[model samples]
Target: MNLLQKPILFPLNEKVRLIQYITGENSMLEHIELSIYDIEPGGKVSYHEENFESCVVVLSGKVTVDVLNGKIYSQLGTRTSVFDKVPTHSVYIGKNRFYTITAETKTRILIAASKTDQSLPDNLIKPEDVLIESRGSYHNKRYVQTILSDQDTISDKLLVVEVYTEGGNFSSYPPHKHDQNLLPKESILEETYYHEINPTQGFVFQRVYSDNRLLDQTMSCSNQDVVLVPKGYHPVGVPDGYTSYYLNIMAGPIKVWRFHDDPEHEWIKDRL
Candidate 1:
């Protein structure tokens, strides 16, 4: 299956230029929907979800989010590039809520959604509230920012995170899969990776494959490219001279994340 999706350019006059990375109508995903919106200043995008919850992540510039009931969140972002290596701000909107986002400046946002009936209050996630972790060691090292985790019952099935892999490094290393719903072992989850290259012109290599090679594809993904992982052990490798950044959105029947690493590559963990 061809899982790599590239964004089609839209004219600047279009107040809101949206690229639907993954949606129920377009993909094999069962629980997640991902989209990217590039809104010019003074532009607005509104949404009302009847049976799904969503989280809006600011990738660049600033914006204000108004959740219809006179609740307004203003100036919600900073940093002009994902390469800034800074934690971003995001807003979580529960099912049955109506929210509008107005760009205070030229802004880019990523929204991830999943089916849910959880009656959670809408909340804003600040940069300081994000947990930053450094995983792996040496060349396999990568920095991770956890946006939403299972510990936070505020969300139903969505798990969001941002990762930064330095030049000539590896991420999602030792190839792992979470496509089985066995508690304490692995949980079934479908995921989407939205990638951005530091130099913009550079690219990263991502591989999606099953043990029997039933599903295997290695792709050269550029900026604004999205990769879907329906069922497989997926991993990424970055070429030298350019850094790679990607926002990952995952959803499944279970909220927690547990994975099984490929036995062949499991030994790599010992060296780390």
Candidate 2:
């Protein structure tokens, strides 16, 4: 087995492959798993009992999600592309359930799964139900759409959110970390950022570091790339002229999200 580096980044080429499983034997991931699927019109993908909680987010085009052999099903999606910055659709399926996704058009979907035994319901999150909010001040401002979690829907261990940062803006600002299991202060969570740049050729920069700089690393990322955050304060910067979009998927021992910001930059929040 090959383990991935702390901040693993990889580009995705949709033209050569239909489905790319981002994390595998060569990755350091222990709980969270992710994959990107490029399905053609009328294409289908099936899954049996895998004993994992999963969320299928339609990045573009239309698709019908059939769970438990159509016992639970829904047609979701609308954004022509992720760069459109519009709210899209997603489906959450609980552990040990069979599911199938059928594309009605050329579609790109993100499948994020986490091993769990918690019993939750199979549900659909419509565009309207997605909580969209703008955070930060001036140049640091960015839009965030929460797809699943305690604040919106009920789930066992999966937490999903989509973030859109304008060109030259900062996201996950001030640097925050959820790497400790400190009850009310912070909770240990493993996260991944699936990125998509506006121009399809643009890029972004991300930093992951610990208190003592033991795991510090700054990485340049391009469209259809993924950044894995195992721990530490993570912050992102989008260069001028390119809007950045990333789908965040997180899961850990606790279902709640409690984080601690880098003390040095935490002051920035007071002025916001």
Candidate 3:
């Protein structure tokens, strides 16, 4: 059966230059820009504003991230990811100018910040604030480098965070929505879920609006299957058994999210 039948996804077959900005698809939450990114062993992504709340996840090597505010190389989460929401200029010093999976991507999602996204509060949590959360699965009770999570300290200009649930673990269980303005503390942030399931087997279910029929999408994603949730009340359903994970890149008008449940399954919330 076909698993990944969601939105549009563009793949890269080659490497990117040192300073290049490639546009990504226009998702509901924000406009995206993806690049392969090259650092000369001791180079940094443009010294631009933390504008756009960007994220850099190491796919295959090591990077020493440094902030200008006396915050030296804070964390070395090689084989993991790092996130920073505050406004600060960063410099990434790599081991060499060789080729490894390093990505520089920006998200347009914002909350309580100017559209230009050029504001900082002076002192943010130290580089130590940038912590790496593992996002992988366990095989035979042995850990495998599958999934990880690294969230920013500011909790403002959010970027992408990786989440890996057990192959059969149910995440985002009951269907829900983030469009309810009434529950600002609950349902307010737009989301974009990029999936990576194990063995590329099994399927994930996501449902949007429907005039008469449910605009549901069942994706059996492998390496690259992206689903952009702009403004629909959505929920994810992981089948009975399947190791699953996704890089959830989100941003919106509000800082936090409180999604509402579908009327039919609203009862599940009480028991859960």
Q: Write the per-residue lDDT of candidate 1 for residues 1-272, one digit (tens) a residue.
A: 67888886564457888865578888888899987889999999888888889999999989999998847999999778888899988999988888999999999998899998676888899999888999999789999999998778768899999999999999999899999888899999999999999899999999999999989999999999999999899899999999999999999987989999999999999999
User: How does candidate 1 score on lDDT?
Assistant: 0.90
For residue 49, give model 3's deviation from the true position in Å: 6.0
Q: Each candidate's TM vs. the true structure?
A: 0.97, 0.91, 0.57
Q: Which stretches of candidate 3 lie over 4 Å from their true place?
A: 1-25, 31-51, 66-75, 78-118, 121-155, 200-203, 210-218, 239-241
Stronger candidate by lDDT (1 vs 3): 1
The candidate with the higher TM-score, 1 or 3, is 1
Please list the residue runs of candidate 2 whose C-alpha ends up more than 4 Å from where it truly belongs after superposition. 1-16, 70-74
- Each model's RMSD to truth, in Å? 1.3, 3.3, 8.9
Backbone N/Cα/C clashes per model: 0, 0, 13
lDDT of 1 at 136: 96
For candidate 2, the per-residue lDDT at 75 reads 65
How does model 2 score by TM-score? 0.91
Q: Per-residue error at 79 for model 3, in Å?
A: 3.2
Point out the worst 10-residue segment of candidate 1 by lDDT.
8-17
Task: Compute the lDDT of residue 69 as modeled in candidate 3.
Answer: 42
